[model samples]
Target chain A: MRSWWRVLGVVLGVSVLFVGAWAEKLVVIGPWSGAEADPFVAVLDAFKAKTGIDYEYRTMRAEDLSKVLPAQFGAGMAPGDVIFMWGWWIAKFADHMADLSDVIADVPFAYVSPLVVDGRTVGVPYVVFVKPGFWYRKSFFAEHGLKPPTSWPDFISLLKRIKAIPGIEDAAASGDGVGWPLSDTTEHFILAYGGVNTFLGLIDGTIKWESPEVRAVFENYLIPYLDYASEPIEWTSALDLWWEGKYGIYFMGNWITGMVDDPSDLGVFALPGAKAVTGGPDIFFVPKYSKNLEAAKKLAAFLMSKEGQELRAAGGGKLVVRADVSPTAYPPAERALMKALEGFTLVSDMDDTIGGEWQAAFWDQLKLLWVKPGALDDVLRVLDEKFPKG
Target chain B: MRSSPRAEPRGKGEGKSRRGLPLLFWRSSRRREEWVAALGFLAIGLVLIGFFVIWPSIRTLWFSLFDAEGFAGVRNFARLFGDREIVDLVRFLRREPPWGALLHNLVWIVIHLPFTVGLGLILAVVFSKIRSWWVGIARGAIYLGIVTPLIVGGVIIRFLFDKHAGMAPQILGALGAPVPWSAGWTAYPETALLALVIGSIWLWTGFSMVLHSAGLSTIDRELYEAAQIDGASELAQFRYITLPLLRPVTLVVAAMTFLWELKIFDIVYVATMGGPGGASNVLALEMYFSAFRELDPYRASAIATLITLFSLPVGYWFARRRLRR
Candidate 1:
């Protein structure tokens, strides 16, 4: 009996020690995985090593994030200490967001815009996404003696040339299924055809939907471009096709860098005729309702830190938020991406400009336009009546 | 062995005295005991219904008359179909899935009803006749769909229906009646709705089959035998005996199917989200979109109310028939 008690005591002591070494988890939720989330893993691992604090990062779909966060906020349930969010969601959940001005004061002004709601800085910025880069297989372009175009007419000619290749299905097509990728790209059409002021005019009501400029956007830019694109499907699957050399080109975001199977073989060019490349960061914020507010703040602060941002940009193929952190500091992949972004004017995406309420209706209309090309007049008429500007 | 007149009076006197001595308001002790037991059984269920169903439905009804701002009357309902064009009305009337939420739901009803219940009834008939070691295995195979969750089934369907890699287009192409599904059916407007319908039928035909197989068990076998002995053909026997006998079961299936269609969410949600452009958009998806995306609970509530109103007539008929039978 004495011997058995001694063995049991030894086992219990080891168990207690093991349990004592583990910290309580600080849960963070976001829409990222694979290459995207891998960077955060490295950053978080460093945080854990430094502070002896642990975290579980959960990935969710953007659509579900929109639904889940609001419901969680409404129910007074803090699902996590930190959340990754899109621009429009910041508008919807601004009240529940903890102001991150103290943390993000030194971040670049461009990255700061999405997080500011009603003059309150509600989020810390990370993972800058640019929406105008068109990617193609370098070998495919080289074999065909093709070159990237400098203008819109040249771009169309290039698409036609790519199409003339024996079995090419599309020169470019959006991963057009649910909402985000297509909606992100649609604003580019407005920029490409009507110019930046014309695009902004529609938002402010100076330009009517019935105006010739908006009509030209539908007839000239959106429809003509979609002719070379594939039918609507999930964006991820579409990205897979781009990787497989099925589609010769895909005009989407820089996040595609994180998704590429091989970095060296990829060729990217800025979208032609757009006034600027329009997109911004996937902002990370600690919510006011967070159960682990201090830990969340620590995580956000670490993400913005030079060492943390470097690991994130290198591992995640992301752009840095800090102005001082140059592309040269990043790994070759992101460094190349930053080099590609030079000389292009940068503007905010429609997600930022259009705001939240009208965003859905607008995106859905774009989808409708892609399918029912004949429904353009009717759709615009409805959009005008529904969202009339003076 | 007739009882004497005094014997009768004694029995009558005991009964009369028992009835006359109702101290605790129990005229009949056995019936009162039965009533108490029945009430006890219903108490939990009633409380659940009151808490879960009744309260939510009442709130939905109240919310329907309002808009995002406040109680703006039936303006939300007007806006629900407010954007519809005359051509759209014609398109919806023609039973197409592209035009309107209400019309798409109607198409879902038309497609889902016959495909689910009819296929189920046919499968049930085929299943009922078999008696072998393979019986359980075959039945299990048929019920495999019902066993799989809707989300899983939807994902599988999406893969099988992929434009480049899916089996659907390949099979359809082989049939020589090729659909323009080179991009997959769900990638296009008209066909996205059809894809969802096909996927739905795949998921729920088994559900209908299970209900029908259970219904098939209670049917009297002798009726078929009697008709057969009288020189009736198998087809004639089914018509006279099985079809007429299965009316009640059919009503139950129809009512359940209609209700399910009225509130159907997962298939469309997981499969297409009423896209490639809101082409396959149904009332349930619209309600959810209106609530979350538009943040207009009034419009969402109105759509919910519309679904309920649409279901009431069929539900009422089912209840009435069930009570009568």
Candidate 2:
């Protein structure tokens, strides 16, 4: 009886050890799914190959992450070991996240600074998607004998010419959804007309939203063009319209390269005198409540490494945040945009950086401005009031 | 002979114990056990309601008092009224269509309620008189909208108003009407709210029809025959018999519809996202934006409380009318 009891105890102990090892796979939650998730999954597969650490990727909507993560963290649990989140959200929930300073030490401070909160590095910078400028079809522009604008006047002339095309309805398509696409286009106008200081100052709350420089950008550049603006359509739908030559140009992020039918047909250019381009990195972080904290940290560290960024970049639609990752790893369109970005001052996306109420208001007011240009004063006033000034 | 306890004619105080307690207090063991069993059944439902509904509502009301900075008393309420997104009286006075979220919801209720109720009655009356097999098919087809989920209805609304392939734009274009909504009806400020409201009427008219049809069946056929013997026309008979008889059902339908309109969110969320410059924004969507997007729970709670307050009166009126009947 004593001998049998010893054997049973040994078997139970071995089974426990084996089960623990089997459950070591990290759970990673991200916003991408389907074709959009393909590149990200490729990187994860490579990580799994190099290290025996497997992972389970859970797809979640980007917007739902902000709402879901807080509730999960409040319950002293988390949906996943690591989460890909917006930088502003990382700041908001910094207390619940694990400090990732050591993991992302080699990353540039410019990229790393936004994810820091209360002296704790809460997230590591991942890939960045740039709002390069208005993307036009190379074929459409060539067919219409239209050239990309070199100045503000030239841009207006281009719009007029495009509007005169047989099938075109508008000079530009206004993409919307919670009004962010219009906000992005409006930001481009601000950056081009008001200069980098005015643009950055407005974001940091140093320059008032109702300031003359800001108003001038709206009145001089945006309002006159409102007459030729397409009615606000869903961003993806707007892309389809632009592709079909119903609209001349669409101001969107570099991520459009992946969404379009063919990247080779896409052509992009910034506003004539624009000195800065707005974009942000997709930041990922480990939650403190994660049971597999060490393994999660290892996965996060690997993602930020050049090897992992290279794998992601080669798969297309994303630009690497790491300086060590080569531009050649990207597809031609992304590679060219990456090369061009070296000349421009990279500013973080305004509404994304200043999130919460201000971001919502910004998007809403931009939509209002699009439909009713006369309400510009009211829009600017509301924006200023909603701005989170300290 | 001693009377059995069950057959005993107990006077007001005859069943009382020495302390003057009622017979229920000193009831048989079986009666006490039955009471315990009844309470046990009720306890589960009471506990669930108290935990899920009552506690959360009370908590929301409490939270609404404070703002983002700290314990701001009545400050959030003041903001809720003053915020242009909630009620832009200035724009309304200027005769702008897309006034505010509150005003938009009112617009939805005003237009949607009457049309749905009136059309429902007309369809029910017309269908009742018909004896064709297609009548059942027609009724089923109409009620299908009611069975279909509102989320799916929202998608249907989107496509119905879409410029590219939608019937509305195409039909208008063919008629040589100037189609201003090049992007689609829901994508424009002037038409976003109206489009959703009109589309919603189609979705809800079916519900009203089904209810009214059921009510119509309960009316006496002899009443119409009596009116006809007195040389009453069809319209007169409808006015005297059908309208009066259907009053209770109409009250129920209208009140329920009113409450539904006040809290309408899913359709607006899926279709327009309260966009085209918040032109089609409604109260429930505002609450969601406040809590999730803005991350201001206080303002969200305030909006929630207001929705509940708006709903209470209609609900109260319905319950009171039903009780009176």
Give the top-scoring candidate (lDDT): 2
Per-residue lDDT of model 1, residues B104-185, tens digit only: 7887889989989898888888778877798788778768887888778767777767777788877876777444564477
**TM-scores for every predicted model:** 0.89, 0.89
Can you tell me which runs of candidate 2 are displaced by over 4 Å?
Answer: A1-26, A49-56, A106-114, B1-34, B68-75, B176-183, B225-231, B320-325
B1-325 in candidate 2: lDDT tens per residue? 6544556556774554343344556676569899899989999998999999999999999999888788888888788889888999998888655587899999999999999999999999999989999999999888888888999999889888877767787787777766445447876677788889988998999989999999999999999999999999999989999999999899888998899899999899888888766789999999988998877799999999999989999988987887897
Q: How accurate is candidate 2 locally (lDDT)?
A: 0.85
Model 1 lDDT tens row, A28-129: 788777766777788889988988888888998667777777778888776788887766667668899888777766656445453688888887668677
Clashing pairs in 2: none
DockQ values for all predictions? Answer: 0.43, 0.47
lDDT of 2 at B153: 91
